[model samples]
Target chain A: MRSKKEKKEIFLFLPRKKPFTDWSKLLKNDFKLKHFYKSKDLLSALLFSPPQAILYYFNRNRTVFENLLQLKHNFNLVSLAIILVLEEEDLEKLSDDRILSLIDDIILTSSTPLELKIRLSLCLHRLTRISDNNPLTGLPGNVSIELAIKKALESEVPLAIGYVDLDNFKAYNDIYGFSAGDEVIKNLARILQTTILEKTTNAFLGHIGGDDFVFIVPLSMAEEISKEVIQKFNALLPAFLNEEDLKRGYFIAKDRQGVLREIPLLSVSIALVPITKGKFKHPGEVAARAAQVKSVVKKIPGSNYFIDRRA
Target chain B: MADPSEKRKEVKKKIRKLEGLPALPPIIQKLNALIEDERSSLTQIADLIEKDQVITTKVLRLANSAFYGFPRKVSTVQQAMMLLGINVLKILIMTSSIFEIISKEDVGLWEHSVGVAACAKILAEMKEVSDPQEIATAGLLHDLGKVVQMIAFKEDYEEVKRKVEDGLSPLQAELEVFGIDHAEMGAFLMMQWNLPERLIEMVNSHHDLSRSKKYRKESALLHLADLLVHARGYGETTYVGLPPFDPKALTILKVDPSEIKEIYLKLEPRLYELKFFTEELKREMT
Candidate 1:
């Protein structure tokens, strides 16, 4: 039912809700779209629209930012965006100095006042929610993995820690600029998410900031997730590296000091450590142990290593 | 064909005239003259200040003001001298002579003047220039015109104050008030006192360095030093206007604008030292 021109241009389809909810108060006034969702098509005929109120509002709330990012429109984010401006009086009222002050105190509640410790514990229950994890590789960041391991340990459950490193990232970064390196990081992030998270009941995926990731999965699915990571990575990684690099038997990589060195072609090294309350006092210790085992596996050619806490 | 030094001297003399500037106490003049003499002794210096009961009292008060952090009360001018030493005595003489009870009613004027004096001395020392002492003397008197304006044109001065707050240059604000500025008056007083040509030029060109014909180097240095002090936001709120920025002044002084922040950070710790220096000078004057 879309016109040829409409089909060519990309647009984000925000949920069309009637009369907006009280939750709309969390949104900055600038983000509100003019021309309420009366019709299927977006019309730009409204007067008193700020040229870019949405940009300001988007900065305040990144979920709306994620909504903007989903827009398939080929235009740069700036050119494609427009905001619904309010009257001056309304803008001033919307700034809501008192509400901001109240919210500041509310957020501060968790971070302060030892006398309110009991209240914070009660409030703490509300902040915890289940998290989605990368499936192709389960590795997330150290912080989340530490939390996940803590949760697993609390319930005396089996928790698996996976440390994922790209086999020869430096060579790719040297050939392509840092932007391409960032893509590799993102692509690998998604790989881990898809491989390790898709099946596990409770999993966490995080980027440990640059080329490294950590994943925490229930110990029952540890071997399954580990095999999926290696299988998917082997299948997907060749496509990411260019044709010539793939042709060469050994991929060339720069070591830490930037001298070019030959590295064994595209492979992943994962260390699966089974979390035990006796040995793993904290999630951090498990992640650290996994990293240590990862370095040892990285020494071997093309592999994954799993250390049962019993061993 | 007025040299900046000559112009500055002419201005200071005029300011001195306008204010009927009270004389420096005879004891201070004697001490200053003695210090300048080929043969001057600590005992002689101490004895001269001791002759005046008021000066001795002031000297003892200064020694106690934590400027020295002396272990025991300094009961006499000699005891104060022994506690502070000769370098401190010289400073005491200079500050006391200039500061003479600048009424607290006009809170920051004296403070600003002292801050400028210390800044000029510090700057001159950094340049390894000769006679940082004379530079300090010049800076102390540089704002003599403000005093002149304060006394002569109170109403118009307020207008100038408003103009400054509204963002006019201090020179512009001064022209609105007394048809001239403190730099001009300060220079005139320096000339009347037969101060060195360097001091005179410093006063005249402290505000408008680029305009000076002679003593350009001294004027530029003075301008740079004045801006540094003004930026410090020390002293009184009565600085005639926002201090002007002269690119040429910094270039002449070989001071980078970026370096100002780091240099100020280094100088912050020395504020108490400068305060002590000022308090010391004030005591000697009394």
Candidate 2:
């Protein structure tokens, strides 16, 4: 697994050219580039250490082109972005079809090194910022959250999956419109984000869509994060509700059966499922146990978080 | 010799008269309009996609798929736009509509489409194609005409299947019965949908790679991808035995003969993921 912050470099496979031209100097400043003259050198280097990007110069030789195409699967496997540079007339050979179908981008060899730097940086920036964040709260969505939990389980780490849900969200949404209800969800997300940031830097926050937010953190730091999130969420509940509802401490709303009943003020419940080694093989298992714990915790009063300490 | 133009006109007329021949979804037309508009923002295009629940869901699903290897989960249409960009999203929307229609007739064909999509993606990556997504989309909908044939001319399609069961290839059967192959019929539909000329050419010449004048390389990519999927025994079709590899296409792709085993080895593992994905798609669409 590649760490998030590491020294990343690009590998350039170009024909032999004079060293230290004006254009090459521009790229040398921002990127740590390693130049390879032969296909064998590049392929061998990739086997030992994969580069973030590959800059290939197209020569009219069919053998060289085929050899380069052979490495595309390997490049994709290691998440490498391939940039091809070819002459204008040489580009005409591929003009009859979808010319650059295999690689990430193509540039005219006539372009300046500054243009290359800008284009390459933009592509690299995009590669780094691939986030599947929930639209409402901007927290990571289920996929990222699930992937994190699975990685932790695979590593035999002491992680906790905290399943957070609002106890009377539907009742509140009924009294207030969906937009206002959305605001409350966003507020809760903010509370979770801030609590995790303030308490633990390594924690992962995700929105499991609609009134359900999940956070995965180290087991030791899980209790503190969950408690702080619940505390902050409860403290902000009054501002979320109207003055009339805040004064009454409850609101009259219809249950699923349409029967009128007084529902208590909105409170959040957190069910922390500790991910122990050998206990579970997948994230779905953690989700199942978290649901069981949530059923028990949601029944209790006020904002609270409890860890499921069961086999 | 017969006039090729006269034959093409007749084929176009025959395709237009086919019963239950569906047009491209209205959303695609709207998205295309937005794409061409220079003033349109990504937010505006995403907003239009958000109006359609199915497309939105599919977009998010593809963004998070293994093909993109997007590091984070893509939840919203806006995020999917950033990950896939407009070109890929357009192709995805078009194919999803086609898949929805064909899935009703034959679940096996849908699996085949998914399998072809995965294979084409790998092949395109191998060739260093600039737009793998477009080629993958073409692979997914390569058999659009066959589905239409089954829907419009049920009896004729039944005969085609019967012949296929008897060991005649599906293409040969279509030619025997209808005087036109599915590749031709598929190209006709692509033309009707106002699809990209490159895509139309690929579909038009997938079976006859030599005939592809402009999109020879792309057509070859799809041809090889289709053959690879057939060899893998995906999609419970009556057609048996792999289609002979097109020498012209092989030459155009510059693929080494020795690389066939390697291609199969890489494509084999991804087939499982594609099957799982197709099942999930069927569940969601229904």
lDDT of 2 by residue, A1-311 (tens): 44434536888877666322444577767777788875545654543345778777776345545544434421223246777777888776665332354566777778888788888888777655764666665566777887888887865568888899898899998999897788777667656764565445466778889999888888899998887677656654654566588878898899999999999989999999888787898778877788899999988998899898886
Clashes of each: 48, 11
For all predicted structures, in order, the TM-scores are 0.33, 0.36
lDDT of 2 at A131: 46
Q: What is the DockQ score, from 0 to 1, of model 2?
A: 0.01
lDDT of each: 0.53, 0.68
Q: Which candidate number has the best TM-score?
A: 2
TM of chain B vs. native, candidate 2: 0.66
